[model samples]
Target chain A: MNPIRKVLRAGFELIERPFDRLFGPALNPVAQLGALGFFFFWIVAVSGIYLFIFFDTGIERAYQSVEYISRDQWFHAGVMRSFHRYASDLMVVMVLVHLLREFAYDHYRGVRWFSWFTGLPIIWLLYVSGITGYWLVWDKLAQFVALVSSELLDWLPIFGEPIARNFIATGTLTSRFFSLMVFMHVAVPLFLLFIMWVHILRISRPKVNPPRMLALMSLAALLAVSIWKPALSQGPADLARVPNGIGLDWFYLPLYPLTELWGNGSVWAFLTAFSLMIALMPWLPPLRRARAAEVDLEHCNGCARCAEDCPYEAIKMVRRTDDLPFPTEAEVNPSLCVSCGICVGSCPSSTPFRRTEELKTGIDLPEYSLRQLRERVMDVASGLSGPGRVLVLACEHGGAAGRIGDTVVMPCVAMAPPSLIDFILSRDLADGVVVAGCAESACYNRLGVQWTEQRFAAERDPYLRARVPRERIATVWASALAASKAEAEIVEFAARVAAMPPKRLRSPLPVSSTVPTPKALQTERGTT
Target chain B: MKALRWIGQFVVIAALFAGVAALSDWPRYSQIPKDAGVVMLSFVHGADRKGECRRLTPEEIAKLPPNMRRVQDCPRGRRAVYVELDVDGRSAYRADLPPTGIAGDGPSRVYQRFVLPAGRHDVAVRMRDSARADGFDHESRKSVELMPDQMLVIDYRPENGSFIFR
Candidate 1:
């Protein structure tokens, strides 16, 4: 990570930690707020379809029909109307939260800029769809909206006459005008959905909706609100008279008040300038792209483990070119890879026991390959002399773990294979190993913390064997704000390991099973 | 126990929803009074006569396509109307109404509403068409009695050559 982003991330962590502790990880997965936005959009769509059936599109009947739905069909259609309005409002909230969260995480920089750029348009489309929906009701509030919107449109040079003329008199408004409003209300939402789909196009296995339990709770809350306070339309539009005032839904119509203060042209300028600034944020400071991962076909076993574990879907298993023993080999697509290197941990061939000419793995990052990792681990282990000499493996994004005196920092803790821990133990290089990473719900790489935990527990591939003492290992999930807690965890683990009897090593695993030394490989080949 | 905990979480969420619903203060129709008078002002202006084209010259006609040549090909620009209204000698409303369509060729229409006290009052209205800017092309001043909840309309009639109040 760049120095500026590192400082920015630390600042964000300082603010986020207290809130995380208050809300608990499961209840406050702020990282997944974008998925929650999608869930709310689905609710809005379903309820909107229900409301559409009862809507009248005639100029005279539009307001009357909405009133009938709210008053006469109070039980069903009325509740649906409330749901439609509230869910759409909530979608805006979720999108804003998601945008801020990404900015804080520095996820909008470099290769990730595509998602951020596409997201800006979604905000505009959502607002357009929402405003058109208000117009469809044709109430006094709708009349206000039409007047201001027309004034704003008239600010542009393209129109010959002021659009405000359409609503100047009751005789001028026609059913055809109402039809155009209905068409836009429906069309803009469809466009919004399409933009949302494109927003996730680069991500592999994108999580479009939040966890089912969370989704259920959110939906239930919305339903309760819908029943408790049904949505109602304002009095029928009276273009012949000026409206004194109208209730405003602050969530969607926050800028409407600005029109009165700033005038329509200035308000339009403010909104457009704000949107352009947000869209261009990625290039404001500029960031260097991380190196992509490389695949070693000779070592690949066609297990497709890397493909399965990749959060970005940058890796694929294809037919082997040479006469390798495996029929398929792993391949990395350079463009899509963020160089997270979690695939290195997923590959069984990444074991450090090998003594070949060069340490190699099936899939490895160019800057931080398995060979470099092995050397760093051995160097840290060899330097430890005193009792309770512990090696703490930490993720770069997981706090100030790398700043600790005796620690090996991986791009992500998940990028460190389980065998690496066993290798350290067998060599007696460290008295204990402590693994710390990002908070489980807030992994910057999405699945890093979970996959690391799973690998250690033997629930996923490249699992730690039973022989490795679980007692000597401790995993602490920490955010960047919890540096002190992580350090305390490491100290506590060292004490616990010092109390136990020295781990008696069973016979070392056979050479081939472990990472082979070059001489060992040569001798084995000669024997064969 | 897990299910019970889940239920408890949902109850908390429901309480939150109730709080927000209470605080929203959404408006309702029943709040508006039934007895309200509305004064409607609506009119379409006469066609503009200020910028009509002159008869084509021989040289101008000769430059046209063979099939398009004619004695005259005139262009008519729609009138721009200015309207002003006064209630009891206090200026209540004023606007410059442009032609309706994108090309400024459609009917010039104005629809506006003014809510006034339900009582007798003096009303004056004036309008200027495109052909003359020095004075109003039409004007009306009248004394009228308005009943409670009455709807008064002011319209323009080309055939009658006057403003009609109903």
Candidate 2:
């Protein structure tokens, strides 16, 4: 990772911890920026619909209709206008913060580039929707927006006739021009919604709405401010009189002022160059990812667990191409894979109890195979000499890397199957096994920690056996910057493991595990 | 204790939201200084063809095919347009706008704005669009009182007999 990105992620983690503690992970605003953007968009849409009910589109009646909403319908329609304005402003804030967050967290690189690239156009559509929205108000502020925006647009060679001519004087403006503004204010947002959908098209599951409680609280905040200060228009536009000082929505209109400072041509050039740079960011230095996971048809049972557990939806179940008895076989889409290795852990055939000379899983990463992982674990565990003799499986992107003598680094901690933990403890290779991964809900691979927790608790497939001592198995979740905290957790778990009574070691082959007793073989299925 | 923390977080978030929302309109922005006004000159007009039609010579007509024969031949290109503005006897703007299109046969477009002090001032605008380009074909001069933050627009319409000020 870049040093700048590391610092940014550390800063984001520091800011997120307090919010996470207060509101809980599900309701944290910093984590739910994309969802909050949707929430604000809906607020703006609903309120705009209500205001449109009383809005008149006529040239002479447009300003009066809005003024009437502000003065006569001060309580209902008036408040709705304020909601439309404030929520739109908040949407801009959320969109920008969401972009920065994704970039800082390194989510905009590799296979995730589709979402980031699509986001650039969504921004332009949003600004178009907002600027046209201001034009519909037909106030001095609207006039300023119209003239400045038109002049900025005219700088391009695409337009044969300058749109700025329409705003030369009151005589040049027409009712049809007002109609076009109204049409764009509505049409552009509908297109914006379409592009927003495309922004998340590649992800398996995307959060499009904030938590219910957070949404309600946001609504209340907007309403309180609406009552405190309603959105009112500036004096009606008079082309004969130049608009000097006016209240401006800094979120959308800040670019208009830039046109003045930098000149229209320079501003246009800057915007074009800036947008192109952002759009091409993903390929500026493409990510060097490990080889994608490959499927071993002989080991696969068509269970479909890997397909269901894959965070990127890169695995699929297809008809068996070989003479396998199962109806379906797992297939990997290499383009979409991030080489996380969660699929290997999810495979039922990934157990260490199989008396094979060389272990192989149904779906496994080529660079970091299950065989390499099992060998590393056994080697590290057998060398431990202390009383606790704990072996730690740590994620490279998370905490605990190089923190202990008995540690094995994997692409993700979830890559270690629960059966391997049981095998280590039962064979007396180590007195305890600890799996440490990225912080909860903040997994570098998105669902590693969640799946790992569930599998250990026996709530998910390929669960830990019932006979493994619960106290002997421990899990720690911490960010890469919190190495000390993870080390303390390891020490605490080791002490607990040391206090437990020791069990006789099961008979083991040098290259295989002994079979369990009948009672120990019985599975304990967790309630759904 | 958890409930108290929740309340504190919510209050802080709401306060920040309101603070930014207030900035949507508060702290007014001035686009231009109080004592200044703007003058905009904008229009689109096509100049006459660059060359006059000439009767075809006997040998030139004989070389043409029957369907392509014509009594006269004329150039398709149009002349470029030139414009100048004098505010209070000072040259404020001058430009020669070339015709648009691949063959240079389209209209020339212009949109320019300049700032001047708010007071009575003499303004002069001139344009030349014909073959004889040394002198102006159309001209307008006016002495008008401009209020602070007022905008005056200068436009052209041949049908309206030249410059129109608003």
Candidate 3:
């Protein structure tokens, strides 16, 4: 990672840890930025609709109507107006921070480019909708925004007649002007919502709403602030006079002041270049992607577990093309795949008990096959000499990758299935198996740690068998910079494993006949 | 202890909201000075055609295609418009605007604004839209009183045949 992003990521983690402890990891705002944005969007929309009910679109009445809402209906419409404005401000802050967080995590590259690319237009639409919303108040600030925005548009060569002419005098503006502003304020946000949908189209099970308690708490906070300091317009706009000092919403109108400082043309040029650079950020330096997963038809039983478990939604079930008895088979779209090897973990055929000369899963990464992973684990386990004789399956992106002994790093901790853990403990390969992945709710592959936790708890498919003792299994979630914490966790788990009673050895089975039967396959599928 | 943590989290969230509200409207922006007035010169006017029409000879007309003959031939392009404004005997704004459209056959548009002290001032504007180009075809001068923060607009209309000040 770049040094700047590394520092930023660390800073964010520092701030988030306390919140995680207070609100719990599931409800932390840092993990819920996207969902919180949606909550704010709904607040803005609902309050805007209520404000429009009492708003008049006439040029002369527009300012008076807003004043009435702020003064006459202070308790209801006034609070709603404040909610509309402050919620909008909050949304912008959340979105910008969200963008920075994703950039710092390097989530804008590879297959995740679609979300980042689609976000560029949302930024424009957000500003456009916000600027137009301010214009509807018809106050001094609105007049300034109208004239400056018009002047900015007039800077472009495409306009044959300068739009600034419309704001020259009091008689120049018409009722149609307010109507147009209202239309833009409403229409742009509706289009923005569509783009927001497209932003998460590639990810499976995107969270569109925050947790219930978090939402209620955020609402209460917004309400308290709305009542404490109500939003009031800066005075009515007088076209015959120039607008002097006025309150400015720094979130949306920050660029308006730039137009005056650095002439309109320079501002426009800067905006164009900056937007273009942000739009092409994913490929500013193209990524070198890992090889995608491939399917082995002979091992596949037409089970859709891999398709269901894929975080990228890159896999889908299709009609079986082979003579397999099952009705459907998994098909992988190579372009959308991140080659995280998560499908191998979800596949029922991915078990160390399979005794074939070459162990192949239904869908697996070509670079690091399941057979190689098993062999690597066995080799790492054989060299352990301590009393605990621990084997750690660590995620490459997390803190435990190289911090402890007898470690075998996988692309994601979930890439090692529960059956692999059972295989190790049952064969006396290691005294304990510790699965360490990225920080909670911050999985590099989105759901690697989540599914791994569920599978171990026997709540999800391909669960750990009851025979494997739970005391010998431990899991740790930490970021890449938390190496000391990971080491501490390993130390504690190793001590516990070392103190446990010795396991009863089972009769050794012939290696050539360990393939799963039909009934065993059904059990792996969680259908029996 | 957990309750205390929850209270602390709520206070932090409220503080964040208060911070956003504070910046939402603080540090008031002044777009224009209080004791200054603005004058904006804006107009959209088409210039004269670039080339004059010439009467075709009878022989030339006869050689033309049966349905494609005319008495005169004229070019489609128009001349660029030149405009200059002087405030209190100083050049304030000047532009040589090109005609609109790909064929250069449309109106030339311009909009410029200048800020001056709020007091009595003399304003003059000149525009040239013909091929002659050396001197202005239309000119106007006015002496007007401007109050603090007042706006004065200099506009033009083809039918009015001169500059219009409001």
Best by TM-score: 3
lDDT of 3 by residue, A1-528 (tens): 788789988987887777777777788888888888888999999999999999999888999999999999979999999999999999999899888888877788899999999988888898998999999999999999999999998887778788888887878789998998899899999999999999999988888899997887788889899999899999999888788788899999999999889999999888899889878989977667888888999999978999989999999999999998989889999999988888999999999888776787899889888988887787677667667878999999888987645899988988987899988887777889999998886788988988999999998888988888888899988888888899899889999888888777552753344443323434655764
Positional deviation of residue A17's Cα in model 2 after best superposition, in angstroms: 1.8
* Model 2: lDDT of residue A172: 72
Pick by lDDT: which candidate is best?
3
Please write out the lDDT profile of model 1 over residues B1-166, one tens digit for every residue: 6777677667765665565454443432211234455566777664664476688999999999999999876565577788888888999888888776666776666766567767787888888875775788789988877655555777778787678777
lDDT by residue (A290-357, candidate 2, tens digit) is: 88999999899999999998888889999999997889999999989999899999999998777676
lDDT of 1 at A414: 88
Q: Name the Cα RMSD for model 2.
A: 5.5
Model 2 misplaced stretches (Cα beyond 4 Å): A402-404, A495-528, B55-73
Task: Report how large a share of the reference interface contacts model 2 reproduces.
Answer: 0.69
Tens digits of per-residue lDDT for model 2, B1-166 = 8778767766867886898688898778887888989888888998878899899998999899989999899888888899999999999999998987788888898988888889998999999989894999999999978889989988899776599888
Model 2: how far is A274 from its true place, Å? 2.0
Query: Against the hidden reference, what TM-scores do the models get?
Result: 0.83, 0.91, 0.92
Q: What interface-residue Cα RMSD does candidate 2 give after superposition?
A: 1.5
Q: Between 1 and 2, whose lDDT is larger?
A: 2
iRMSD, per candidate, in listed order? 5.8, 1.5, 1.4
